[model samples]
Target: MNLELVTVLVLALIFVLATARSVNLGVLALVAAFGVGAAAGLSTDEVFAGFPVDLFVALTGLTFLFGFAQRNGTIDLLLRAGLRLVRGRVALAPWIFFALTGALMSVGAIFAIAVVAPLAVPFARRYRIDQLMMGMMVVHGGMAGAFSPLSVYGLFVNSFLAGDDLGGSRLGLFLASFVFNTAIALVVFLTMGGRFLLGRTEDLAGAPASEAEAPGQTSGQASAQTSAQTSAQTSGIDLYQGVTLLGLAVMAVGTAAFGLDIGVLSLSAAAVLALMRPDDARVCLANVSWSTVVLVGGVLTYIAVLEAAGTVEWASGGIAALGVPLVAALLLCYLAGIVSALASSIGTIGVALAIAAPMLESGELGAVGFVAALSISATVVDVSPFSTNGALVLANVDAEHRDDFYRRMLVYAGLVVGLAPLAAWTFSLLPV
Candidate 1:
């Protein structure tokens, strides 16, 4: 068999092994990268060069920065503030969490899920809200803002399009995702019994305020400080947490307004926080999702080899020969949505864009709209049980009926995978 065919077959095998054996797909992909790189007649150095250094820096920096926030009780502070903003309106509780998480993702996608899912799931359980509703809303909110101009997804799409000399609208993609996710959230709110929460605010605050302390901390300190902190929180934000919130604001505005390098600014802000709270260093560092970092590094490294070997071009060429741009677009959308529902949404988006670029350049379809359809469809299905955001929710639930929640999420996510691509495509067909 030819080199291209061999590498493609290996790709299929990696997915099968990961699914069947519950192994880290990244590890398998890294091994395949070496074998495929060698089979393609590339030198060792060239293979290593395919490593995605920039993405590594981006994911690590954001996770590291947010890790500090998580440990320092800053995220807890935000949750308290959001709950207060809802003012006992349980019906609005999920929306509050949704908007806040969406705003975070507008700044950065990967870090948003890591930070928000932990908080939202617990909140859902506390109020007897549907875990699937709350969890999936958080996922949708993350994807909603994920395509904003300052976000990684938007940056990736824009850069990819620019490289192809295509004129794509950054705002268009953002709007498409925002609208699509909002519609989904609305449906969830109405059908999932959100209306039942109205005027029913008792017992919501009956649960004692719980603190999100760094690992290795004591309940003694938390108990002693809980009343005072709760009182202070009622009137105003805690001093240290307020400062951390300010720092987060700067991270957002600095990157979005001033066009600062997000990775650099995140690391700098986290470093400052770290210096101020040296005792929290170990816990913060421990919380950064190293597995995700490794997954991204490995998967993209393998993808780089595919790019180097002209496999992406070969795929696009075949898609182009189909003679129907819309049909090709739909197929690619379904492919991206299906794979992303199971694996890395970011990876799937990158690969999908590579395949769609040829059809996009043919001018038979609207470049901006098609890109929006591709990206939103690729990410919105992160509600699937197999995806990180979905799994995060399932993990955070109280152990009671955990499997039942998982099954519910599975059913909901399956529905999204089946229907979301069509909605995303319809939204993209609009002029916006």
Candidate 2:
């Protein structure tokens, strides 16, 4: 095998193993991608060219949009609404968080973590809730969005499988399953996880008057407090108008007006939104997680080289040689999901789908099963100890609530692992 191809395969395995170890697989993958390209004697431009520019743009734009939502009390409003809906039921908090996260993701792909992070601390502190539960909710919420059509995960997966006979590549169909998974998971969290883990009175002590006193005032008080903090430190913008206009504009213009890719539109919107407020530009930029950008930029180069060198092709052939294409594909996805939990979902999904694309295209794996595996495989990174969502929970959790966070993660992971495979198995047994 060529040195470049060997390097790509080795990096991919490292990426998967790193997920189990809770390292930043994206950063590592990014570095490896560049190194392999350089080792192959590819130019800097060529090495970097494979990076997904459009997705990065979308990710940045989504970050800014989330910043806008958090600042203008849009997310606060939603959070307040969630508190009211739950009505002091601690067990229901996880599902409430999950639903809210899903709703935000449905609108903007990458905004869930940014939107949910700050809230997790206060909510956990207020309710004396489990930090892990909060983390699970945040991770799952963002991931649910990532897997949605609005997210780059779906876009990248689709782009790789584009024009192929794979049934799993359909945007609407994939999203339908994504939504169902979230919904089912949300319900399970509320009913199964909620009854046992939630409803502790001590948890609601963070906002004494908020949840227990009048209940209606919970949302109002929380909203007021959040707005004050955000506005005091920074000037307020018309968050509702800004987000609504920007989100709608991007979707409409990208799809209708400019005929541009959603990622491009998303990225452009971020730049445009930043330009809207000169004074807030610093804050907005600061709010954008550039580490993630750097991580993604590097991986783009890596995956591109993987394609150029036929590393993924050869690996697919190796799997075929095992004479268990479906099982191999499913296992690959499982490994991908776990790895994704560490790096973030997009990179894991990017590499996994990249490797599997050839096999799916070759009819080594059935279409329905392929999509099922893709959907299931895309979410493992959501709850990893090093995941962005995991970071949010870890940072937000007080000492008292630490155990709660882990407990919920254990519950969430177990369910996610179990449910995803069930979905894939059902797909495998289907008529197709």
Candidate 3:
């Protein structure tokens, strides 16, 4: 059998074994990557080279920093401040998070999500919001602004087109992504218990102390009372929290404005906080999502092996051989969506656009619309649990709910992989 086919089958087997046996998927993936890499005649160094070290640091650092914040009661303070800004309207919380993340991603998607997910997940827990819904909103919000002129995605697409002399509309691409993601967020809101949040308000301050201590409360009420008590205690920021907040601001500014590496910056900030409070550091370090870090690392490592084995090129070559421009365009959209769900969306965009250049030059497809559709198709699937954005959200979820949330995200990603390409193709490409 061809190396490409062998690698693909190994990947499928890994997924099946992990799911059925309830083993850590990342562990299985690492084993598979080694076996497959050896079978494909890769050296040990080449095999290990695929390990996502940057992602590992980012996940560990972000989780640790935020976990420290939660331990010091800073998260509670921020939550209260957020509630005050929104006038305690619980329903508006998701949208507020969406807008905040979107605005941040207008600078860069990776950095924006890294900054947002840690805070957003804890906020959802505190407010009793749907975790999946909140997570998806944060991801979709990042995609919504990812194609703006100032963003990395937007600059990459535009520069690639200009360099290759493949004509496309910069404005159209940005607007399409923004509008499409916004619409998807609305659907998530309506279907994912968002309506229940309407007309619900929580006291910006803790619930009245007398009411919280009153007897005969249901379990739900008791949970709320406990949460309120915690919030009340942490309402005021102390010295440690002030320093942590400063570190966060510096990390944000350094990453967004100065184009510093987010993983390195986050780790630096986390290290500083850890040094100041060794006790809190021990507890927060225990809270880091090491399982998620392993899972993402192993999957992406195997994906790199697949790329090395020529699986991606093999698939794209087959699509290019179809000879029918429109059908090929649609298939390319699906290919981008599927591969990107498991891999880097930006890398997928470069591949798809490079492959589509011939068709665009022949005037068989509209450059602007096709590029826009393809861009959106590639990115909107970042909600997949395997992707960096989705993995960040999963890593930040409370430990008790992490497993169920991973399953839900996987299912949601499947739905998106099935439909988002078609929808994007219809709306952006078909009309043109």
Candidate 4:
């Protein structure tokens, strides 16, 4: 009932509303953080502390590193190999891209939008598939990694849990859900139909027709096509670059061997890579998303206000009081998933865990129940209108196909809503 707590609660609601309506998540997060901090009588310095400096530094390094890799043919090598491997297997491109992206996402601890965007077009062209589908594939694949323990949000959640056994609590359940989610993504891609892409062959074959035309007859079209093709060719990676291999190895070793935090370690690896080729530093820097960094930083600092005001504690109590046990418990978790979808997963999971941790300690819910619920609820947020993944996928699609893209998103969303919760319920019954 405290005024500060009330202010935090209201701010949280407003943040979710803005995000749900497709407002810039980072901007909305910053506004909520600052607004709540001011209302709750927090100092400006304290309010700004939530800015994730470590995350920013690391991401900055990663941006530069990725840039170098692109410049030096590291990423290009990988792309070439990937494309070759995907040859004549266009329908499976999305799934393969998703898996690879998921792996990288875990290491980088941020969405690979920059990396995915430029490359998706080539893969689309090669497979004679729609650009929209290619975009969705990369977006969807990259997001799967976001929920992994190596992800920034995952680390944030684990940090909040403190002594609680997060890895032990839900590792199996999370893995299971990942499998099911992958299956669902595959199903969606298959439903799009492989035959729809055959028409691309005629367009691709038309390249010869242009050569037969006079230099002036098809000059503009040829020039544009050449540029697009060159861009795509540059994006291809060798797949055997020593730097690229070393970088991946270092990321994995740093996380598992040294127990170094991914956010820090990821950027460190990227920095090292950038330093190895200072000539391309600017490209690497350009690749980094300063906007995302600033956004994440602002929100983190702003949420610190709620922590100070004890708003999280109050909200947790309200959620627990909803009364669900046995069969109804599944419904409760599903509803929580929807709420999480409306908010960013990070916000919902953070506040919910702060509340739920104590409940688990009190024996109201088992470790398995908590883990299942959290994982399911968190994953569901990926499909929400406020979802970073959803936004990125939609943004990258060709303007002409946005409606079709959105329609597919809705279908994907329905699948997530149903399957995520079912997996949660099934996991709840397991012995984890």
Candidate 5:
């Protein structure tokens, strides 16, 4: 087999082994990256060149900030505030999470999950809410806003298309993502138990667990009692949490408005928060998603190796040969959704553009619609268990529930992988 083909098959086998057994996928990918790169006649540094250092720092910092906020009772306070906004309706928290995360992403951050997931997952557990439903909403919400004029994903795709002379409507890109993600969010709401939440207010946030709620309860019910105790104990915010919130705001505004680097700003904020409660600094560090870092770092490094080995280009060439415009549009969306789910959301946008530029240049497909298809397809699948957003959700859950949450994320991501690309393509072609 060609080196590209061999590397591609090895990547598939890594996924298979990771799934069939109880092992960290990141570990497998790192081993696979080394083995494959060496087999393909590359050196160690070339293989390691794919490690994403910026992503590593940003994930660590955001988790630190979030963990500090949680440790100091800020998260409980905010969850209470969000509950109040919905008049104590538990179902509405998902929408709140969705909107909040979407707003953050629209402001230019691609890793809105790093900000929202830490907050949403715990909030979902606190209220007897469906974890998959809530987490998926947050991920989709981030996707909904990720193509805005200021968003990292938006700027990259737009610049890529423009550079290739494939003209498109910027407004169209944003609208397509908004409409498609909204539709998907609606599907999640109605199908994933959202209807049960409608007009029902029986479940109060932070209520003490009843005798019927088992200690070994595997999902949402398990977290409620613990969350309730935390909320019940917390009173008004103190000076430390107040400063922590301020630090969070600084990171948000600095990165969104001033175009400050996320890692730097987040680390600066985390440092201030750390100083406020030095005792909790260790706690904050402990909560950082080390597994998530390893997973992203390893998978992306291997993806870089694939690029070096010509696997990516070879695959793109195959997709380009398909003759039908609409069929090709759907497949491109699928390609975007699948790869983006498994790898880097931001990087996949570039890959999608590169893969589709040939089709766009042929003039059979509309450039604006095609970009929209590729844009939403690549972004909305961030709920994958291996993806940064989904891993953040998994990482933030109560430790006892991590295994179960990971499985749920995989199932939900699988469903999105099967359906979202078609939805994105359909929306991209819709008038206006």
Candidate 6:
């Protein structure tokens, strides 16, 4: 076979192997990169040059900084503070969780669901809300804020666009994702028993004070303790948390206002925080998502090798030959959505955009809109029970209803997979 066909087949093989073996796609891609690079007569330096240093630092730094916030109880504190705003209104609980998850994901999408799912699942059961609805909202919330300029997903796409000189708007992509996901969340809320929760209030006075303090406490005592803890949490912020918040604000302003490098700023902020609490820093360091870091690095490195081998141009040439830009765009969207449902959304995104690069360069489609459509198409499917976010929700559910929840999630995911790409295309790409 020719080099182009061989490269394409190898890429497909990598995905298939990774999915079937549950191996990190990045690792598989890295290996493929070396093999392909050799066959293409590329040098060692050229092969190594594909490693995405900027993306690596960004992923590592952001995850490392957030690890501090998570381990220091700041994230939980923020969640409780947001929950307090509901004031025992059961209807607002899902929205509250949704908003909180979005806020967390705006800075970084990693672990946002992991942090919120356990709390949200229990809240749903206690308030008699539909567990499926609550879970869907939380996942949607993460997607909503997932395209912020600072978020992992945002950086991944934006970096690729910028590096390739593909004209696209960072802010536009963010807004598109936020609006589309929020609309989906609204639908989930209304249909998933949200209307029933309206005007219904929970008696927080009788509720457990805290999960930790709930054990071995009488109902009356728990109520009193809950009141005390709520007041304290609301009234005061811990020293470390306050400092972390300040660092976050600084990072935001510096990146948005001064055009500072996000990766550098994140690491700088993390380092400063570490200096203050060496012990906590050590613990948080270990918690960074190294697997994700490796995944991104490996996949992008392979993409670089593909570029060197003329594989991207060859693939895009075929796509462009389809003769209709709109049809090609929709095809790419469906490809991303289908693969992302069962594999890594992050990995799928890199591949999808890489394939679409030449078609986008033709100027027939609006770059920003197409990117948004593609991104939404890829990520919105994370509600599939096969994805990490859906699995987390399933795992947290009560054992009695777990089977039912899984089936419901599966059906909902199927619906999303079938419709979301078309909807995303019609709304985002068709406008162009």
In angstroms, give how far residue 354 of model 5 lies from its true place: 7.0
- Pitting candidate 2 against candidate 3, the one with the higher lDDT is 3
lDDT of 6: 0.86
lDDT of 3 by residue, 1-432 (tens): 888778767766765676567577789888988988888788889989988776677667766776776678665455456556877788888887787678656643335676677767766766688989999999999999988754557766776677558878777888989999999999999999999999999863443212232223455875676676775565477779998888777776886579676567767888998999999899988978677678767866776676677775675567667877678888889988997787657656765776677677667788878898899999999999988789999988877788999998999999999999988886435434
Q: After superposition, how far is residue 175 of candidate 5 from its true place, in Å?
A: 6.5
Question: Model 4, stretches more than 4 Å misplaced?
Answer: 16-64, 70-73, 125-136, 163-174, 194-241, 325-343, 366-376, 380-386, 422-425, 428-431
Off by over 4 Å in 3: 88-91, 97-179, 187-235, 324-419, 426-432
| Candidate 6 wrongly placed segments (more than 4 Å) | 203-235, 427-432
Q: Model 5 — TM-score against the truth?
A: 0.68
Which candidate has the top score in TM-score?
6
The estimated TM-scores of all candidates read 0.87, 0.75, 0.64, 0.74, 0.68, 0.94
Q: CA shift at 80, candidate 5, in angstroms?
A: 1.0
Kindly list the per-residue Cα lDDT of model 5 for residues 152-201, writing each as its tens digit: 56655665566568888777888788878888898888888888988777
Clashes per prediction? 0, 12, 0, 15, 0, 0
Cα lDDT for residue 26, candidate 1: 75
Residues 1-432, model 6: lDDT tens digits: 789889989989988898889999999999999999999999889999999999999888899899888877777777767767778887887888899889888987478988888778866775678989999999999999999998999999999999899978889999999999999999999998999889988753334213322223354764566667675555568788898888788888888899898889888989998999999999889989888998999999999999999999999999989999889988999999999999999999999899999877878788888999999999999999888888988887877788899999999999999999988886445443
Q: On residues 223-261, what C-alpha lDDT tens digit does candidate 2 reach at each position? A: 566455553424433554456456645674565455566
After superposition, the stretches of candidate 2 with alpha carbons farther than 4 Å from their true spots are 1-5, 9-31, 38-45, 81-96, 109-111, 120-135, 163-180, 190-259, 267-272, 411-415, 428-432
Error of 1 at 374 (Å): 1.7
CA lDDT of 335 in candidate 3?
88
Output the number of the lDDT-best candidate: 6
Q: Pairing residues by index, what is the TM-score of model 2?
A: 0.75
Kindly provide the TM-score of model 3 when superposed on the true structure, using C-alpha atoms: 0.64
